[model samples]
Target: MIRRVLACSVALVAVCSLGGCGTLPGFGDDTTEVTVWLMRNSASDDFVQRFKHGFEQEHKDVELDVRIQEWTGIGEKIDQALKDGDAPDVIEVGNTQVPRYAASGGLLDMTLESLRDWGSDAWLPGLAQPGNVDGMQYGIPWYAANRVVIYNKDLFAAAGITKPPKDRAEWLADTAKLNSGQNQGIYLAGQDWYTLAGFVWDEGGELAQEGTGDWKGALDSPAALRGMAFYKQLQALGNGPRNADEETPPQAGIFAGGKVAQMIAVPGAAKAIQKANPRLADKLGYFPIPGPTEAKPGAVFTGGSDLIIPRRTAHRAAAVRVVAALTGEKWQTDLAATMNYVPNKSTLAHAVEGQAGTAAMARGAAQGRATPNSPQWAAVEADNPIKPYMTSVLNGADPKRAAKAASDRITTLLFP
Candidate 1:
């Protein structure tokens, strides 16, 4: 296991200091080289170059070597690097991956630094809470992206819907009006659990609850069942596959076919729709998923990246500085503007004021929530029972029994 390899390097963490470490081959003795591994497409090359120039101007003694890595098989790559004691000083990982790495004791504890310099209190709860594993902050939130209702403007107009829904009731009403012969109101797949997670959270239900030392699935709870009931009611409005997810045949391609009126996706999906069928380039619009009431937007799963410093990095201080710069207000604002991402902190929403899609995403992210903060959560996802449970419910199975069965599987995986 990766933990075994990471555990062996715990002793080197204390001695890995910037000034005390040996220099890299290309850098002079006076320079501290900080290597960063960012996921592909997270930032544009131009934006990275701009950051490098600006950061290097401020810290002349440090050289930033930023490398973009592909997402496929990244977990194993990261594990291997940690095992070899050759991990990058800073790495960008999914927010959900924090617990697994932090639990392995291969991450630098940044609780003090987060509180002292990064203003930990104001960060978005969805992005912030997952990083705070066992009361210690390991992942520093970089940027966030969540699902929104990407709709066809022409379809809404044709249906006489003057505006987007302000609440779940209105959304259902609007979708029903838009769903007619040969047209789908919304292409919401039955097993799209990330979207389902929002409804569960809206009803104040958790997918899994943390107990004394383990997690127990809570999908069988009354509130969660109510959320599932609502999902069933909405899924019947359109012709989404009950046994598949948004990506089975690529929902973006389906939406681009011009018969679907709406879909729940990140704003980035609009680009794909446009790419598939260029006619939708100017016909699309975005809005946050409406909540049960108009008081707030629906809760969404905040999917985004976080920056981490490996425990065995030679340039620990330089890595910390690099993380600070990336998560700082200046770069955060630039990143949001350039990439249309929600800033790490809710206070930075103003950065994307004029961008409609990102603005809607930011609003939903205000009430966003992450998955269960357990090291075994990743394993649960790998062999996910929730998808089949959703399908079973949609296919006429008893909700309570299906939920109970899925919950049992979850408990076993979470505590395995």
Candidate 2:
């Protein structure tokens, strides 16, 4: 049996900071021990144990030892572990973080056929692309989600709008109807990079374009500036807190008051709305933000996790098997339902297709995209020039000029 290791938050951080302390969850007497590290909350203990036991059943001599890690300082911690020759057999990496490891050759390079054997064409849209660096598979997607929009049903009824907006004009028109001056409509976070990217992608814009040798910032492109202009246009329709960005996800708090007609939402938002204002919780409805074409959902920046084998693991074959089993069809189906994530394997997302909320999730997942390919993306995100540049455009600076400045900064980050 695998043991559970629990530590206080402070202790956990300290232990991780000085490189990992291995054998936390368990060290079975079995000769073959396969250790796995999972990001906290990425998967529930119950399901993980199931996979652990399943792997053991398949390989009688091997024992699976599971350890939990926090997102904070994880990259540095993992790197420390590798430096100290204490890396785990398999590690779960955030999708966006895959490039850093893959480009640095910190992960094993599995052949394309080997990856297909694990989860092939049935994989969710854009989930597998991040793992394919230079056309070699270094990681496999585990799960995914599309950030979406949630609106007040009561406000929709009051406006005589029977359905959610199907296109940009309809979206703006509905917001106009909901804005009675005492409260705002269409609560958009000014500095939120994900939603900002969504608007850009909705109009066929890109945050950065991946080049042969390095990534180039595309914010100055006509399509991207048009999207930025559209984002500015939305700010004009509704008023909320200014200077907000990913520093805090401020839209949920603003829209939970029930007076706001609509706002962008994410997973766990329903529970948050209930906590913020229980009465209006039941009135909330969800939909994918529609694209320029009414028939398709707007482009969402799909976020997800990936499973990879560290280059140093001795039991490469065993670790690969565990990754394959964990991402198998049966496990994928149950996990998607439990976590309310669009399954990394989209064919398995059927678990939630019957409901209005999850159906919208399914639709959005179809139109979703991962971030552009750039190992140095961490630098861009760290510098975070895009949000402030967006704020400048919203604050009346010329959109093209603002975009050019942001693009220049992004180019430096992506190259430097």
Per-candidate TM-score against the hidden true structure: 0.92, 0.88
Candidate 2 residues lying further than 4 Å off, grouped into runs, are 1-31, 246-249, 354-356
* Candidate 1 deviation (Cα RMSD): 7.7
Model 2: pairs clashing at backbone N, Cα or C within 3 Å: none
lDDT of 1 by residue, 1-416 (tens): 89977875664444444334445344345678799999999999999999999999899878999999999999889988877889999999999889988877889999999999999888988888899899999999999999999999999999999889999999999999989989999999999999999999999999999989889999999999989999998999899999999999799999999999999999999999999999989999999999999999999999999998999999988889999999999999999999999999999999998998999999999998999999999988999999999999999999999999999999999985
Give me the displacement of residue 341 in model 1, in angstroms: 1.2
TM-score of candidate 2 against the unseen true structure: 0.88
Model 2 per-residue lDDT tens digits across residues 1-416? 12334346566768757855443444224346789999999888888887777778888767789999999999988777766667999999888788888766678887654555865676765678777788887778888877777888988898788988888888877788888766677777688778778888877889998767878889989888888877777766677544776336556777787778877767567777778888986798998887777888788887888888888898887788788777887777778777777777667767777666776777788777788778889999888889899788777788888888889899899985
Count of backbone clashes, every candidate in sequence? 0, 0
- Runs in model 1 deviating more than 4 A are 1-29
